[model samples]
Target: MLAAAVAFLFLMQSAPAALRSATAEPRVVTPRGDLAADERATIELFRNARDSVVFITTRQRVADFWTRNVYTVPRGGGSGFVWDEAGHIVTNFHVIEGASEATIQLADGRQASARLVGVSPQHDLAVLRIGGAGFAIPRRVPIGTSRDLQVGQNVFAIGNPFGLDWTLTKGIVSALDRSLPNESGPDIRHLIQTDAAINPGNSGGPLLDSAGRLIGVNTAIYSPSGASAGIGFAVPVDTVMRVVPQLIATGRYARPALGIDSDDEINDSLKRTFGVDGVFVLRVEPGSGAERAGLKAAARTVRGVVPGDVVVALAGKPVSRFGDLQARLDDYRIGEAVELTLLRAGERRKITVALGAGTE
Candidate 1:
């Protein structure tokens, strides 16, 4: 009886301490201060630009032969931004390349149908207009010139990366004047390169300067694994500013053209055979500016095939390759006169040709 009484007394002494230990709370550490100055600026930039950035989804019509029915299937999607108070949205051309329809999701989670306004495939940019009523259009993005942008300057990208809406990435301009080929048009030139973590769904989004002004349109990235590899290219805003107006007006951007078709392979062969470096004028389109300027085409004579006028320069800019000619002509506008230096036989001649609109 005496031992039982001592055991009960020990249990009574330890029971309260055991219960206290079982219900104890853990301590947690958290950030306690406000953001830094630059951090706050970045946050504010995203806040101002979020409404302008938008999410795009595309649909294509697929026909079922056996059922004799047509269905609209989900195709692909990317990003875009508000271009004006008129409700125009700007995005990459490839985003809606073959789509029959598109849907736009706004920052406020409202959805609307979008119609293709115009597209400049050469620059890989497209404009869309939102349809339906009662939906408020977001504020347009502030435009900035790429000509004054310098390497190492801070840049930002806002897009729906992987369908995650309103994501913002920050980085610096890595380079300028980068070139990339378009699938359906002329090579895209004068591109702005950055390392802003642009990914597949980031295409057609806006690349902004530190002031939250749109500097470029994010289009392509350099990656072997089909993901961003730190090198991403955007169509410069100067080109966008020039092309978008034309698209909005005419539903197409007419590139300035000389209207001469040159064979790059033949030009290379001619360079080796004739010991000259110039684009070989294989054929000149009839009624074109080149033909009007008396640009001759390669002809087959009785003795042998003879080379025609090889374009050597355009307005004092050396035209060593066929792409160089296109790049130089792009700097001009339709009906603008540009001096062309050509080599015929062994003599060089200068002629002025009025630029024409490219059929592309």
Candidate 2:
């Protein structure tokens, strides 16, 4: 038996190499066909929009409590996009709200210091300028109209989500004219809602259309886990188109106002008292547009509780909340005469009032 086993081993050792090992040959490659049209379109969209998107890093000034020394520390970062050929960057106001300084990284691996140009906290938008000697010009994103956007249309979001630089996420426009609560001021109005996987670092990034045109600025997400839960919001480009140009021109954006003083809490109280829903006029600014238009304020007279003019509509659109009034005012520019439907003495009256500079 031992002699027979030795003979078998000797025969196996002399066998062919293919029989001794599993690595005989490589498998045949399966060729992949050309990319689908949609895939190609997505790739082209990212390619065209890549140069316009920028990664922003910010630092915050921190003070030593014991030593009383102030120094800067890395605060946070988000995304932004080039607005024009002049190196103007448009981003969310919350991105650089308390930032001491910021740096912008371009697509070509170049970094430059950014200076705040202007900001509209109410709109959650800010404009920054970055240019010095030898700074290369950035490609401005093609602007698209958000007012004409339709639900379920293909939308692309280019941002640096979770510190992943220049990441592209695609989804459809889940909805439009959405409003999100903003800590800075009034609720952000006319936001374009999408399911584009926008995360923490996606804020201020450009939300592009299928044609690679900028339609919105990615702002916030509706997530409880601090991650993208398939719901994201962006400031519509129509508001961007109006606010960015004004931010570039002026150091501050002056929102158009009716020049009437009103409060939400007080308005709620008035609503309970008067049993009506609208912006309750508490006080009208002297010599202002509302005053010139004969808008009256609530007064405590000897006759009893004299009700004020309750603004109910703007340009025929019903407005029920103070935020609604502010949001509606955003649709028109200052100095433009807009029709306001007021509820006075339980009767509806329409008045044309020229918008004045906002005092917010």
What C-alpha RMSD separates each model from the true structure? 6.5, 5.4
Tens digits of per-residue lDDT, candidate 2, 1-360, equal 999999999999999987877656888999999999999999999999999999999999999999999999999999999998889999999899899999999999999999999999888899999987777878899999988999999999999998999999999999999886654456679999999899999999999999999999999999889999999999999999888888899878888888887777778887898899888888898878998999999898887667889998888888777876876787788999999999998899999999999844
TM-score of 2: 0.88
lDDT values of the candidates? 0.89, 0.90
Clashes of each: 0, 0
Worst 10 residues of 2 by lDDT: 179-188
Q: Candidate 2 — which pairs collide?
A: none
Segments in model 2 whose C-alpha atoms lie over 4 Å from true places: 1-25, 300-306
Expressed as tens digits, the lDDT of each residue in 1-360 for candidate 1 is 999999998888778764556565878878779889999999989999999999999999999989989999999999999999888999999999999999999998889999889998888889999945766789889988999999999999998778877788988999999887554545788999999999988999999999999999999999998887899999999999999998888899889999888766667888998899998898899999999999999887897669999999988878767765776678888999999999998799999999998965
Candidate 1 global TM-score: 0.88
Judged by whole-model lDDT over C-alpha atoms, candidate 2 comes out at 0.90
When summed lDDT is taken over every stretch of 10 residues in candidate 1, the lowest stretch is: 179-188
